[model samples]
Target chain A: MTTSRRQHTLEVLVENEPGVLARVAGLFSRRAFNIETLNVGPTEDSSISKMVIGVAVEGHSLEQVIAQLDKLVSVISIKDVTGKVKEVHDTQPDYQN
Target chain B: MAHIPTANGTAMTGATSLVKSLEAADVEVMFGLPGGAILPAYDPIFDSSIRHILVRHEQGAGHAATGYAQVTGRAGVCIATSGPGATNLVTPLMDAAMDSVPLIAITGQVPSAAIGTDAFQEADIRGITMPFTKHNYLVTDPDQIPGVIAEAFHIATTGRPGPVLVDVAKDALQKMTTFNWPTSIKLAGYNPKTTPDAQAITDAAALIAQSSKPVFYVGGGVIKANAHKELRQLVELLGAPVVTTLMARGAFPDSHPLHMGMPGMHGTVAAVTALQKADLLITLGARFDDRVTGKLSTFAPNAKILHADIDPAEIGKNRHADVAVVADVKETISALIPALKAALAKNQPDLSAWLRQMNSLKSTYPLGFDQPEDGSLSPQHVIQRIGQISGTDTIFTAGVGQHQMWASQFISYEHPRTWLNSGGAGTMGYGVPAAMGAKVGAPDATVWAIDGDGCFQMTNQELVTCALNNIPIKVAIINNESLGMVRQWQTLFYEGRYSNTNLESKRVPNFPMLAESMGCVGLSCERPEDLDKTIEKAMSINDQPVVVDFRVHRDAMVWPMVAAGTSNDEIMIARATAPDWDSQEL
Candidate 1:
């Protein structure tokens, strides 16, 4: 198990419903996982919402967090898109944000 | 069958719809108490087919529901009003969550407009129970009641079952709505993997094939998944020792040769030693709880872990799994059996030496208790007698403390769901009500609540519910007249200060009289000679609930102790005597 802490960005897709964010936020708080930044917005499918969560944690702890997140009935999918964005930015310079 | 207009087209109150939804879900019984906010729902329940057991307290309702669920392998239903009523359910909900009992709690809430304002009898139970429950809902719209009820039951009974709460606003219950049971439920985010990964199964099989000494550390999940049959088959196939945890007292039969007794702080010497010295730990449905593992870092230091559970988060929460299989235990064992048989065909491992060593340890330090120095009746003796007389068909429930441990130790459990307790949460008052619920679920089976004096007083009022409702459960109060477990701790670690642990039970509230007042047959026994006769008398009284108060020694403690925060290697056979681990050769 990797013990060194590193910054990881997790993109969680969830059902757009009342208290969905609270459920996600509550999981982090109850598990004592510190959230650096969290942002949520509606996706192309209006019924679905995407949440980008940033936290500095060990790889093992991050795995645990993802597993716990997967338990929520509202959460659709979770992906650690930490380095993928960087790779895409380096490969396509013409594609600007 | 022709559908009634009330089923779909005709509009009815949400409360009536709720009852219809429950009927559609096949809920035959529910335990609850009615208050102001929940009065509307109770109105419909009067005419419904479902049997509602009116409990004295909301906590009783919750635990009764849990007990019902555990024995029947169905989702138990409980109901309560908002605010204090809902808050009272917190402990039982948490207990059910920790132990993974399938339970549904339907609570009445204040009006939607009064939710944030903290109106009379208002509480945010949905938010309060968020951390503990599997899922929760706050329903304001009357139209959503039917669908939500169906969804709650589905979520509660499936994949690592736990409690689910649906708090409906009072206005919703009063409003007119059409009831329509959903043909199916589709929760997009919730899909549990029942099939084990082929590679993981192969890896586990290979590990089992090579290991000379392996132990099956079983937990409550085995019972929850109803995988005890597969568990026995796998254990026999591998020719390995099996140690059931406190939560899994009967997953493996006590009479079986491969079965070592329960393993934990107060577990048997053979079981604890097996885990401490094993080469491999095949943990099924059981997480490595601190109580079971002792000190995490030092627990089973020589063994590699192969963990399988339905809940993914439990895999590496406390101890890292060398090979983790995320699937239902029943499915895991079913798949692993064939793979392990194939692996054993190529490489047959000899386990005679390991088995011999375990049997030797088992004989050397058997589970037995000495008569108290004070000459008072022994709690162990009473409990053992109760088990012996009641026979195998009985369902035993326990409250937490020395009696709980003794019940686990002395009672010979050969079947799953025969033993129920508040294992994870260790709620003291779980026994009486849980037994009440278990009796309600299994009407023909004899149900016994082996409780401590401290624990009995907490929820003994449920006896009234039992007597009035014709749920005849027998209660055996091991009256030590003090908080026995806490007093044991005081004796061992606190220099026998005693402090506030004493309950003075003998002096205050005569148990037999109290039982009689509650419409139960109250029996009391002080001498060892009277124990069996008293138990027999209690057993004969099937018409009414029975409470047997057996006065026992207060100083008596649970043995085979590994002190809190210590290593399993440091387990003591008695008060100060450690087992001769070096002398035993594997």
Candidate 2:
């Protein structure tokens, strides 16, 4: 049976400090996983930053990548925005790129 | 407190505090070499309770630390200076990361003022070791030394253990400050989930109770979590077989009736076939490595995988798990056993027929090798002899290649941490230094290193370190006169054209002589009859290291081999006749 790869958007909250992004990116690179797009921005809490990363992963690898992202000391929390964002965009008729 | 210089609250140098921090971590020994940039850190070492081993190469120090960690189930510490000294440690750090060994590597960087400048002996070691380490820090202030050191140990030892690097500036070590050890840590994002989800455990238990052809695919995490007892209990409760991976060699005792030997590449035929035919796979603490799941698509095609691991990343990385439990391995396994027992009490699955099938496969294709009737020594015979003589408690360390695979197959491990090899990285030259480290960590255990001619030549310099430290570890080099594994592959796949794989005695450095020059008692056994006596003589000597070189047949290959990218079902058993050799005389 073939398992199709699906696009996943993960929003990770992390400590705003030097090398934190490198730490997260390093893990993905080492595991040989690909990142489709990534964006980092300041969150409500100035001490913590938000990183949104999008990637195509099979069902199993998605769970693994989420688990690995949780292990980083700088990562505060993670939320899967893949299905939620798609739903919100589908409801809004004027929603554009 | 009495040793402090201050009248009211004593102040101390960062170097002194660093040593105190290591003491707080309950470190009894450290493996390292002294250097200029790390000179300040060395000053306090003279007064500390920790014993520092002087290694010939920094790589030796690194692997030695990894060995210590593997044996003691604690974080092993190693030290080095900036530039080349720190760079030499990269390989072991990478190896430890891949294998998830707990290690703490401390390096002395250039002075803070000289860090950015092109100063002598300057290197951005933090940057160099970043990708490989689980966590790392560069201490600029002496006040941060105690806290950083504390966190380094905490990070190194906890949750899916791996190496942690701490680079201290030379000035930071020399600067004097009030010593206030941080009693508490507040790393907001660093907590590990140790308790698995209750529903997931239940789901797994139900799956275990429902399936007849169930197999426990155990990995290194089981050993790391010290959950062997729980694993054994679960296996008994479910009445299923277990196939321990290379990393999980001793997690399940090989002598057990239901134990299928190691699975995947180089694994026994029964173990490989059992995994392929299994309906339920309870994978504990192991990532689905490419080695274990050859041609991943065809691996365990009929099985619904239940992966229980501390690292969530491992669960679905290679194969999709129907039930995923992320928690401490001991906790997860302990929870699983009771649930499975309870589930089985209601309606037990009849696994007797499945067990019979597995046993039949086991008996039909048992791990075997033929003894050369021509009086030529076989490496397998030599290793099996060592295993028989040393008994079950002897810890075996091996370098990569044919000798490593032979050592794994021949040596039967009954306890955890008895087999130490570079499994994931497949590193050559890991045997000697790792054996030295294992001997140092477990002083009372009989530590033996089984190495190949090609692998032994990689890090034999550590024999001097072993001799100097009075670590009496025995090393048996299965000298086949060439890179046996690669040659075997060349013979099978490359049309028998051996290129640069040969390490014949006439061309290469003499192993026995090299061992002798390094202050070891070097013994060679070319005749099969002399193997037992030579090993006994080597084992009797306790004052220094002993090296026994067993020159076996150059072409003897590791049997029951699973060619890379092939299904485990098609494992190649021993060939009836030897293949053709090139110009080299047999």
Candidate 3:
């Protein structure tokens, strides 16, 4: 079987608690998911934190990564922001023109 | 369920709140060892109603908790101090994680201020056990104790079960707190999907109806979900063969006609062959583990996979599933049964050819070991005899090795939860403590730990815990006088150059004498003629734990071998003999 790797971005909203970031990072490290970039900040709701993670992974492996992330109790929600970014770019009016 | 003490907003220490929270969880028994940091919690435990088994080691406590949880289908609880006490629990926690056993481990941390200051007996247990646990918490506040305990139990026992650790600060336990048991737990992202997708179930049914050679690949999750009856029903309806994995020994009755036995390395020939040649694999609650799949690319190459498990991560983690159903195994089977029946009424696949082929393989290459030419007792015989005499009602726990394999292959488990072992972790020294916990869980049932000489020596100190606590678990030491499985590998791949594999058990640490010193009834059997009487004597001892040292042949090896990272096609039925797959027609 041939597996083609792709870059996917995920938006994860988690509880603003101690070790929450460590839990997410630990999961990626242990499962060996390649993280391209990760950014975490407090959400409008200070109790919740949003993490934007860009990962280089294969099709099935990305699904596994999302599923594993979802299993964490601290994680509130996860959205695949990869396609959404493309949708936004496609719908946007050309500024240069 | 036992009476739970009312909180009533009484002012109490966090230690008292912790003990009260345990009572509220309906935890009847717990296994633990107390030390410096955890001394505060032990005081409340001493006054509490919960029966705490003071194990010699924290590892024993963790394994014992696992044993209790596996047998009783409740969250088993274990307690320990920081540093080494908590670190010792790392193995059992990982073992529980692999097997999906519900375990709640409570550890005492150094004071909150001293957490990162390298205080005496301090360890970052929560950070240490993150990967090994389903979830974990580090409680610094005294008020978080009750809530954390409750949530820990809830998370540990729910969905796909696993170990959860709660590390309470020493000051947190000692500080004054008012306890309030939460009426309900709410974790936004933690809800497990119990009901499977109707479309997925329908798709699986259609596939099953169309398949000619399908096998029900069952796993420990079936037993965990208490879905064995549903599994039996589905298998019978399809008239297909079933192969239980090592972790799922008693998930399906061994006596069932469709049962092809366990599959994987050291698995039955028929079971392994069935998986190798199957057209469709109806995987239920079982991940396609590397051990089971052999070489991943070649495993069931022709088979379309129907993977159903409560854990979504496991669905396509190993093999791609043609029809993936993520839900509780019980619910998945319940929904699939009706859909399958509807599909079968329209077009029933003929499996006569497949059944004939399976039966032929089963009869032709039945599981058996040759009598030792050296006249030493056969370990297989000793384990088989122990199973036969003890009967199917007995709960059998085994340490990892050739003995564990023999126990799985030789024993006929008719019911779920009858067999417990360290399947995923393959942790040795599991048998004795696990059996003690099992016996404690089911006082009336006969519990036996089938251990090897190498394994028995690791946690045999727990036999004292058993003796003192009235557990009365029987232990059968399959003393091969060597690391049997590793030695077998050396014999096979390393040209018999034994390197440190020999335990020299014949010289040091006489097992029976050790057992006697630990306040257990000790029995020794060196000859086949005396095996029955010695086992019977061990069985007859109801007031104390019994350890029987059976001196068996050291040269025996587990057969039906699939070398690690090799294809199942290369499975050897015996020494230098591979079954001719071409000759068997389906």
The true-versus-predicted C-alpha distance at residue B290 of model 3, in Å, is 0.8
Interface RMSD of each candidate, angstroms, one decimal: 0.8, 1.7, 0.7
Candidate 3 residue-wise lDDT, B1-586, digit = tens = 1333577477899999999999988999999999988899999999999999999999999999999999999999999999999999999999999999999999999989887898898888899999989999999998888778888988898899999999999999999999878777888868988899999999999999999999999999999999999999988888999999998999999999899999999888899989988999999989999999999999998999999999989978889999999999999999999999999999989999999999999998889998898788999999999999999999999999999999999999999999999999999999999998898888999999999999999999999999888899999999989999999999999999999999999777799899999999888999988989888888889999999999999998898989999999899988899987778775
Q: After superposition, which runs of candidate 1 have C-alpha atoms over 4 Å from their true positions?
A: A1-4, A58-60, A85-97, B1-6
Better of 2 and 3 by DockQ: 3
lDDT of 2 at B279: 96
Worst 10 residues of 2 chain A by lDDT: A55-64
Q: Estimate each model's TM-score.
A: 0.97, 0.93, 0.97
Candidate 3, overall lDDT?
0.92
Clashes of 2: 0
- In lDDT terms, which candidate is top? 1
Per-prediction CA RMSD (Å): 2.3, 5.2, 2.5
- Residue B406, candidate 1: C-alpha displacement in angstroms: 0.5
**Cα lDDT tens digits for candidate 2, A1-97:** 2436688899899999877888888878876777878999998889999998987784346777887778777788999998776677688756564
DockQ score of each predicted structure, in the order shown = 0.79, 0.53, 0.77
Worst 10 residues of 2 chain B by lDDT: B577-586
Better of 2 and 3 by TM-score: 3
Clashing pairs in 3: none
Residue B134 accuracy (lDDT) in model 3 = 95
